[model samples]
Every structure is written in structure tokens, then in C-alpha cells.
Target: MGNYEQFHLIVKWKEQALMIESLLFLFLNIILSDKKQPVSSTPKTYIYDT
Candidate 1:
């Protein structure tokens, strides 16, 4: 029972971490895409522009 509880807690922590990581990744992608526009000389470089 103790081992099971520990496993559950670890799983919960991992899920929260993954969520945070994904959010950060999305933010970075947006920032990077914006930065690329000025350097690339292309008009439609924004990925999430749909």
C-alpha cells in the first residue's frame, strides 16, 4: 500500500511537470517565430496564424 501511494504521487508530479513544460515550449515557439520573421524575409512565417 505504501509503495502504491508513492507511485501515485510520482505520477501526479510528472503530469504537472509535463503540462508546465508544454506551456513553456509553446511560448518559446511563439517568440522564436516572431523573431524569425524579421530575419527570414518571408511574409508568412508565423505558424499559429490560422
Candidate 2:
């Protein structure tokens, strides 16, 4: 096996690691935004002023 060559698996792992990191960042932003700001929870009636 002296002539055998080694295949690089680092590239594959690195790609996966980067993808997971981006997803985690997005998830954290979503979680934090929901806590800091709240969207409308109910519908509002429009009032017309003459």
C-alpha cells in the first residue's frame, strides 16, 4: 500500500460546517427578533376622520 493515495475529506466537512453555521445564525436572529419586537397580534378597525 506504499503507492496508495489519500483522499481529502476536509473540504466536504468544511462545506457542511459553513452551512450549519449560517443556519444557526439565521435561527438565532429569528429567535432574538421575536423577543425584542412584537408584530400586530390583532386586527384593527380603521377610523375615518371628516
Instruction: Please report, in order, the local distance difference test score of every candidate based on alpha carbons.
Output: 0.69, 0.56
Question: What ranges in model 2 sit over 4 Å off?
Answer: 1-7, 37-50
lDDT of 1: 0.69
Clashing pairs for predicted structure model 2, backbone only: none
Error of 2 at 50 (Å): 56
Model 2: lDDT of residue 15:
70
List model 1 lDDT by residue over 1-50, tens digit each. 99999999999998888778767766776787788744345543343331
Tens-place lDDT digits, model 2, residues 1-50: 33332224666676778778767766765786689854345422222211
Q: What is candidate 2's local distance difference test score? A: 0.56
Predictions: Cα RMSD each: 6.9, 16.0
Cα misplacement distance, residue 27 of candidate 1 (Å): 0.6
Tell how far residue 40 is off in model 1, in angstroms. Answer: 12
